[model samples]
Target: MKKLLIAVAALAAFAAAPHSASAGPCGLPNQTTLWIDFADGSVPHWEMFAKPGVIGAAANFIYPPRLRAAGAKTVYFDLNFRNRIGTPSDPEDAATVVDRAHRLFDYAAASMDCPTPWIALNELFGAGTATPWSATNAQYRANVLAFVRTLAARGGRPFLLVNSKPYTGGEAGDWWREVGKVADIVREVYFPAPSIHKQGAVLGSRSMRQGLRRAAADFLAIGIPPSRLGIMLGFQTTPRTGGREGLQPANAWFRVAKLTALASKQVSGELGLATVWSWGWGAWSDGERDPDKAAAACVWLWARDTSLCDGPKAAGPGFNTSLTEAQITLPRSVQCMVGAQRIGQYDLARLTAMTRDRDVAYSALFARAAESERVRISSERILAAERNVILLRFGGSTSAYRGALARAGASEQVGRGVLADELRRAEIKRTFQVPQPSGTEIAAYYATYSAALARSVEATPAAPWLGGAKRGVALASIAPPQVFKLPTGRRTAVRWFDGIYRVRPLGAPKVLGSIPLAQASGPISIALKQFARTNAFQSWTITQQKAALRRARCARDELPHVAEVELASYLPFLAID
Candidate 1:
């Protein structure tokens, strides 16, 4: 009889395993918390379906015994949210806000049989802080502080820092802003934009490793340690692409192991918890389009090489291949085929059948490069949406924006109008300290910002090829040598690169190396044919450098489920390598 152990978590719990997510940190902690997000973060209503023991939605909540075995001490439930259209400041409005929050708390309490829920509110900056809203900055800050204090009495952990453009709230920008005064665990969002056009690319060029680095830097600068901070990264974008909302690009699973691996060395040790944005749904969310494929990847990311030997053995061809290779028909396909990215000798019949029936992988990189594209086809759209929201609220002649303000007990948009008025006064009185440019100037200022936003959206595949993913394809063909030796005359040495491994020449800048997609983990290997120096550090770089295109193009089927507590709740999602 096979002894089986499974672990899986819902959207919210930050799983902190004792050092391992495929030889790193992606494996969730033994004790997992169930989180419910109120935003439309790519996946909608994931909690209702991510229950433990559920099939299609496998890797639900963890079983109590396994958690106890891990010697975990606590169980948690948290609700994630942002302000309700900017916190109301008036006594009447404030009362209504408090009442509504109470009702939500009551509903959450009744809905789940868990402990007292914690609250995580994003964009904690007052209304005046970020956008030109009706509330004054002081009023906005006071309201947020008050509301948070109220929730703190009932276990609320607000997102004290957020990465909003032009403006930010919470601890990162909280210099004298004082948002941390009313907080208990402050979380920060470190999202990577998916615009990969300058080089041979597919999704956003920003790597998971880079995002975490930036996250760590931000916290470090603010004197905040990882113990008090939580990082929120996304497995997929919210379809804010091409000025259209609700687009699912299925940008493969880029860095599950690598991210965990890097987090182990970089930021994971001190962090209280790390979370992926969603559990997603249906057969379209990145690498999770297929249950079996996703499950296979989940197991690998969760337990690394252990999963390869822990099973009844995969019953299929290419047993030596990794789980991703075993599943993808094309040797280097990275995502499901939505449209033909190649025109040459393709296994059309196989491709066709797979496209219609299964979650197949194709090269979004090849297509984007050929189409003069880089990574992140939707990054611009996300920015545009933000700009559009601001413009619509302040400049657009829309009924919804007007009605929203009117309902907020104001005939005009007090926040937007007042801010604009202040800017105008500043321009007029240099000594009196009033801003210049009233009506036309204010409208024009926003118009220019809006135009820039549009230009970004129109700037599809951003720049020219940068000689990496494009000129580097042939380099990948160099078959991987042994872990420590070169093959015969082959000068190339291969090492896996999920952005976690090193990718540079030792002691010298002239040594040449290339990283192309290996069947599963694309490694960065160098050929120091004549220049191989003694004591030159057998391997080159070890830290995740720039975001690699190959990283975004491989479907790591053996990666773990993003739903934090998932992997442990069910049988290993997949037992294949």
Candidate 2:
């Protein structure tokens, strides 16, 4: 009986061996698990939903000390220093900043003393900063190196945050190699811009699949093992020049799925851990709020067990064979689709269905890019609207000129017209209220009027026209027709506009107002409006006019118009006048 049982068992094992090996382990797929680095000190209420056993947190650099004390699992230290260094007042400030940052790190490490890993050493200053690496400034670099050496020496393994821009490659690579000599893991923080245009044509143009491939290659070149490296998805609100804004939060999950799918295609089996750019700080008005909720949703979607090895893993039929051959096999059971239905639930079947849905990937990419485009267009429209207002105020076109005054409201226009009439009356009265000038004077005045009228018609909305017209009228009223001398020692040939003097420079054949001066560049070139103010002549001068031009440029570049106008009052007399 025992011999018969053994024979039966052996037969059973032989028959099941092939099928059992083919079934694989727990249907586990070659998917990347999502982790979040909640850089903001505060945690959001929504984080409670993250997969209870798998979720990890990266506390803010300054606030992590408290978080560690509170028994948080992971803490991230910002390795770089903040505060301005080498400013005019503090040439030695860079050294001080570095020292302070190091001391802070040491204090945190000493206090925590836990065996749990220190996940990220978030080095600050990316492409936007003047300093690419701490080493760009020798003293600062030395301090950072010391801190890095300490981390390497300790049992803690740290990953460095890197920017998308390639500008810091040399410094980053050098640091990585030098540090790797001692550190157990030298991982990188990758923030690839989602949209092709935002990332610029070169990086973004690559298909999600292609981008991941390149990222893998780039990482390998930098000496990071495929297993050790991780990718971070960022949630940025601002759009590029041609991008949109306010993307649906759901789209964030879709993007992650797409990136993960691509990453899976590049590497065989389970790729290393993945992290979202943030967790928490979602409730705070600034930074990404609801990050916890978003992160929870992403992890719930990605944690499903499915294989990527069962399906025919080609990049499709006629594509680059080299690229195709590199494609990683995917399991038909793995779901990559994302939608409203499966957002919060961590159920297995629903997740698999979402991941496999091809439409979800396409829709997600489209929506994210559209949101980015909307932001870009809206910003441009606002800027154009402001330029339109400025042009109307300065250009001498009757339409724009009238429109500007009208927009200023009825009271402002009425006051300006009344003041101009009073000035005209005063001038006529000073000449004994004469009904008419002598025939010779009349001909000269008429000629001046013709020239002035021409200039008024030809004037572009700009500062020079306003200032020139005011000065010409003043000179014409006080001096003889053709040979009036300006207060600035320049001679003017006069013309008249409704009996007011208009002047032109003598040497320049072109009418003075019509002659485009090099100095009169940009939208609102002269201080015409200032000349209309009380004590007009005294208030408007070359120096004052030039200052106004500068202010206009500065205002357009900096503050919005409403704020600019109010701030204008505080500017130097030259700018305001």
Which is the leading candidate under lDDT? 2
lDDT tens per residue, model 2, 163-255: 443222655565444444433232233333345324322123223344444544565577755544554433333434111133344343333
Query: Candidate 2, overall lDDT?
Result: 0.33
Total clashes in model 2, counting residue pairs 3 or more apart in sequence or in different chains: 36
Quote each prediction's TM-score. Answer: 0.35, 0.36
Candidate 1 lDDT, 1-577, residue by residue in tens: 0000011011112322222211211122332222222222222323222323211111113422233233321222332344442533432233444545555545443332223433445544332244333434444444454455444444433344443321334422553233333343333433332332222122232244345545555545555444344544333333542111222232222223223223322334334343322222323455434333333233223322343222113212322233332121334433322133332223322332322322221221122222222222233433333244444333544566556544443333222322222222222222221223344543433333221210000111211111122122112122111212322222232222111112221121111121112311111221111112211211211111112223333232111111111110111211000
Candidate 2, position 541, lDDT: 28
Q: How far is candidate 1 from the true structure (C-alpha RMSD, Å)?
A: 30.5
Q: Which candidate is the best by TM-score?
A: 2
